[model samples]
Target: MFEKILIANRGEIACRIIRTARRMGIKTVAVFSDADANARHVRLADEAVHIGPAPARDSYLAIENIIAAAKRTDAQAIHPGYGFLSENEAFCRACAEAGIVFIGPPVEAIRAMGSKSEAKKLMEAAGVPLTPGYHGDDQSPERLLKEADAIGYPVLIKAAAGGGGKGMRRVDTREDFLAELASCQREALSAFGDAHVLIERYVVRPRHVEVQVFGDTHGTCVHLFERDCSVQRRHQKVLEEAPAPGLTGKRRGEMGRAALEAARAIKYVGAGTVEFILAPDGAFYFMEMNTRLQVEHPVTEMITGLDLVEWQLRVAAGEPLPLKQDQLAFRGHALEARIYAEDPSKGFLPSIGKLLFLSMPADGAHVRVDAGVDEGDVISPHYDPMIAKLIVWDETREKALSRMRAALADFQIAGVASNIGFLSRLVACGAFAQANLDTALIERESAVLFPPEAPPPDEVFFLAALTQILGEQGVKGCGRHDGWRLNGAFSRAMAFRCGEFENTVEATYLVEIYRFALGKRSVSARGRLTGKMIAAEFDGQHVQAVVVAACGALNIFLDGAAHKLEKLDPLDVAAEGGSGHGGLLAPMPGRIITLLVEPGEKVEKGAPLLILEAMKMEHKLTAPATGAVRAFYCVIDDQVAEGAELIDFEPETI
Candidate 1:
């Protein structure tokens, strides 16, 4: 094994690589940008190097800086851990020129497989089955439109050099083709620095299944089964499982062989994934090849009992394949849920803030957590908003799923919005449990997945009020004579704002029980706090929840959902309610990519007013109602904070 290897990435994948490298008796060097100066990966590695600024182009994606860091530390190899420059051909070539081993595939493979259009032609030549589409080099908008018409409606415009759902859009009609194409190109250029795209037939009901294949320099290759990544949103995977459910042995073998063939065709080395789109009729077509470790590799690791990162290192060091194809066996079913600092209720926009309180399910032989953040860690907008990956394993898929549901419910975070509750609901849905999954599963089950938004139970708000008063007066001293009269009860009023709505809660507290009224509804609850947890009995039902008070808000986690109640005074509530005037605000912290309306320009309701690029996705801010742009506060290329006013609109008269 190499003495020292530099991890050319950040966040969870970098930390993940460091753990495996340290276990193999190898020292690891972590490179970080200014944004990740105090990140977990930096703390975990044996040594760390300052790369550049917070922006990825100045840091993680800077090939020269990474190579220089490796050479300065005298590291023998560089492990590009699945993002940024992991699949960049220039990074691999630079590593070779710097005399450092690149713990991944060769530059030829990376370049050959980098462009989707070119890769399709190569795959076709290699006899790999491809979906019918246009993989040509015509970059003109008119040509693409003609190609789309030729292919058919409901086509997918995919960036030639895209992954992780970036730079992809589905066009259902010719009228929407040009606009969608422009959006795809802009995102593609921003993400991969490549604006070229290819048109393909959008598979309506296909399952995203990928094969885990490994190759060694000694000309040996093997496949480690498949993972079903069908449950997705915004074209990105939300949940993944190993040994794709319902696939027959014969079909599995065929997919594995095809994956091996794809690897062999490109002379691929190290760990790579060949993804496919499987139709309902049992037919599958090659989607694309990822030339590095996948984000969902843990599910494969859980099933096969193999360490893919270690395998990457071994293969990079010229070691033979660890195990032959015949020797490999999948042990059990496993599932992984990607925990992101995103609000599913808010169109899945990325949320940036400090993690006030973070608690995860206990890890055991059957459950594991691969996380990149800790309590009090700041989730910035400079990179991906992923908080962690929760993996669970069991003898069967049903057990694994059940375990995952329980694990998700146990996972908790505060000070930033998360999708834990949404994920829990998704896994518990009957369709998901029945394994009837596809890329459009989330959309098809939208009604159930995204239920009507209802305020947390009145009891929850009552608890929030009780906790706020108790915390202010000291929970320990509360039972003492702090607010209790001779009647052994004290009354208090707590005002709070939930999103845009405000409510005032009145409660009378006793030693271990409280009666509260909210919006004309009254309830009585018996609750006590033991260290940060509140155990309560309401409506003859017992419940326990984790609570954290920070940033003038009481964040409570009950039954897998996070509720934030801002403790506001009456004046603050009035100010908040009156602050809204038909102005466009930045939904999240991001740079203004484009402004569709100029000052004094008239726009219709729901018109695309501006585009904000954040968390590697472009979100359009539309007009709330038909209005005239009175003034502009931001322009293209300007970075703004979340909720900052971007436009001041004059509402049109009816």
Candidate 2:
């Protein structure tokens, strides 16, 4: 076992590795960028080192800096925790040359599976089922179009070296092939520095199922069952479960065999994931293999009673497999939901801000939270926005799903927008509960999952009003002289805003009795404030709301949704909504990666204009309407703040 190991990643994965390393009596070293100077992982590690600036290229991806940090700390091994330099074959070779153990698969294995196209070819050669696609080495656009034509429409153009769905696009027709191909290749080049791609038939109603396999230096390889990750958005897995819901014992064994074979084919060592796209008819096709630990490995751990990170350490330390195939037994069903700092209402855009108030479900044997953030941590835009992984385990799938729903409801985060509400609705949906899942599940049930909650429930406004009233009194309980008109009703109006929604709430209180109105509707209630909680009764139903005031914003936790209210004066309505300007603003704080339009260029509505790289994803900004570009404020590689104007449009000539 390594006496000291350097974790070459940040956020949750780094913390996760540190936990396992500490438990195994190994000293852990953490490397952080400027943005993560006070990050949770840094605080957890035994020792921390400053690498470079916040940008991944300057810090996390700087091979020399990471290697130097490891050497300085006298780390015997470096664990590339999933993302930054985890799957880079060059990094593996570099570590070997530096006489430091790389706690992952060997360089040859990583190189073999790094390219999706090459991996598919290798899987085909090994008798693993493959979908109809083109994995040739031709680099011409014309050649790719021809291959797409042969593969038929609705084909997937995937970056040969891509993962996390960054450089993958599905084209439904030949007419859209070239444009989509260009965009796909551009993203691939920007993300992986590899523009080469492959074409495949996009499977419809496909369920993403991946097998967890680990190999030891002793040449022993075994599969730790599978995880169903069909619940996704934008080709990224949102939630995952182990012992895939609908698979029969026979099918599970067959898939496991195939996954183990795929691992053994390349003489793979350490933790790896072999992904497959399972069709509705029980057929499955090989997807690419991830050469490092997966984000959703907790579910696998919950089911198999194993610590995959500990297994990886043992394997990397020249130990044989912990348990053989016969000894491995999956005890129960487990589910994991990825909690992210994103707004589902805003097309799931990554949200960045401080975690003003953070609360999660209690962690125990059945419930686990692998998080890299604390209550005061700031979610920077420099990396992935995942806040934590909420994992639940139970004796049955039904119980597991039920526990997940309750757990999601219990998860609370403020300041930054989150998808906790969306996730709660998703797990409780009839289709999801029934295990009828697909990659398009989120889209198919979009209406119900993202139900509009604007002009929040009357109860919400009532609670907000009560909070303001009690807050003004500076007293938790009502007193004889509480500033309320003892003779008649005392009415006070409050102007408030929550994101793009604003409302005026009027509350009239006489002692403990209160009546609140928003617009015209009024709710009669008797309420009392105790600490930060308000207990109220309306229409013979008791309701309680918890309010946490922070950073000039009142966060009301009710019905599993955090309703943020900002107090304003009635006369300030004029300054509420900003002037409508004819310009393109950066949706979030990110670096400009591509400029698709030049000044004075005429573009149609919804035309691709530029791309912003943030939260490890590339988001393309488009023209709002038909217009001519008037000016450009940002160029390629310029890091801009949120709402920074990036482009100006010429006024429409009526």
Candidate 3:
């Protein structure tokens, strides 16, 4: 084994590599940008290096800084832990020229598989099953349009070097193709610095499944089963599982062989993934090859009981393949959920801020958490918004899913808005439960998920007011102290807003917490001014809670978790930039960088509502249902506070 290796990446993957490297008795070097100066990975590594500024291009992607840091630390090898410079052919070549081992596939392999266009051509020549489309060298818009027309009206415009669903667009009509193609190109150039693209037949009801293959310099290679990444949103995977639920033994064998054959054709070494888009017709088409570790690799690792990163290092060190293809076995089922700092209600826009109350679900032998942030840490706009990847394993797929749902409910974060609530609802959807889901699952069911106006349960607000009054109980006696007043001051009027609508809560705190007129729910809670918690006893069950600040904005901690609610201002004037509610609301607090919509415009339900640049990715807010834009509430350069209403729907005709 190498003496030391520098992790040329940041966040959870960097932390993941360091753990395995440590187990192998190897010293690890962690590189950090300004935003990640106090990151978990930096603290865990044996030594750390300050690379550059907070921006990824200046820091994580800077080859010179990375090389200098590696040499200064006397590191023998550099592990490009997925993303950043992970698949950059120039970086791999630079490592070779600098006399430092790059713990990945050879530079030749990286270059051959880096560009999707070239990779498609290479794979076709190697006789790998490919989707019928255009993967040519032409960059002319006219030529690309002609190719798309020749292929079909419904075609996929994909970036030559794309992942994470960036720089990808699907067109269903000829008129839309030209416009969407241009948009895809612009996004592609911005994301990958590559304007090249290819068109493919968009598979209807597609299932994204990939094979994990590994090779060594000794000319040995093996395939480690496959992972079903069918559950996706915006063409990006939200959940992944090992041993594809509906795949038969024959289909699994065929995919495994095809993956191995593709690897052999490329003479690939180190860990690589061959992705395929499986259509409803029971036929599969090669999407492209990923020349580095995958974000969803944890699920595969759990099922196979193999340390893929350690294997990457061993293979890069010229070790022979540890196990043959047949030796690799799939044990129990494993599933992973990507926990992102995003708001599902606001079209899944990224959220950024301090993690005031960060808590991960408990971990055990079957559960694994690959996280990057902790409590009090700031989630800046300088990097990806993925807070963590939670993985669960069990003897059966259903068992794993059951464990995951329970864990998700227990997972908590206070300051920033997250997709936990949305994800919880998605996995529980009827179609998802039956596993009859596809790529269009999210889009088809988006209306139900992203309701135009969320119904504010007045009961919940009433409960909050009642809970608030109980929390203000200042009785001196400690044990079961109810608000027993010698004097008769029973009712306290308070204002609160659910979203745009305002409500006045008349709370009576005479005996137990009670609502006005509505008979006392007879709720009693006792909390001390100190750190002790309070619980409401009702029907032999306790609603455990903690109240932090005894002030105007009620900072509350309910059900062993904390949250904030401001005192609603009934007299506050509504801002002109938007309706009281409608268009696109800021899911969580974030600044708006660009505007994509205007008033009196006709927009498809899924049209770009606006471009909210946050948590590092541009979240394109789309229409909820096809409607004419009556109003826009935000400006182009507005700094939108979280949950600030940005659009308004026309009043319904009676």
List, residue by residue over 294-384, the lDDT tens digit for candidate 1: 9999999999998999999999999898899999999889999999999898789888999989999998999999989889889999999
For all candidates in order, the CA lDDT equals: 0.89, 0.89, 0.79
- The superposed Cα distance between candidate 3 and the true structure at residue 279, in angstroms, equals 1.5
TM-score of 3: 0.87
Task: List candidate 3 stretches off by more than 4 Å.
Answer: 451-484, 499-505, 510-534, 545-564, 569-654
Instruction: Give me the runs in candidate 1 sitting further than 4 Å from their true place.
Output: 475-481, 486-490, 499-504, 509-514, 517-527, 537-542, 570-580, 598-605, 626-628, 651-654
| Candidate ranking (TM-score, best to worst) | 1, 2, 3
Clash number by candidate, in order: 0, 0, 6
Q: In model 2, where do residues sit more than 4 Å from their true spots?
A: 475-481, 485-489, 498-502, 517-531, 537-541, 573-581, 593-608, 623-632, 635-638, 649-654
Answer with 2 or 3, whichever has the higher lDDT. Answer: 2
Question: How do all models score by TM-score?
Answer: 0.94, 0.93, 0.87
RMSD of each: 2.5, 2.9, 4.6
Comparison by TM-score, 2 against 3, better one:
2
> Residue by residue across 1-654, what tens digits does model 2's lDDT show?
889999999999999999989999999999999999999999999999999999899999999999999999999999999877899999999999999999999999999999998899889999999999999999799999999999998899999999898888889999999988887887888778899999999999899999999999888889999999999987889999988998999999999999988999999999999999999999999989999999999999999989999999999999998998889899889999999999887678999999988999999988999998999999988889999999999999999988898888789888899989889889988889999999989999988898777666777767777777766677546663344674777777877877668788777776567777887787776767887778888756899877888888888899777788888788753646443338889989988988987889998888888888877677888888787888899988898999999998754444
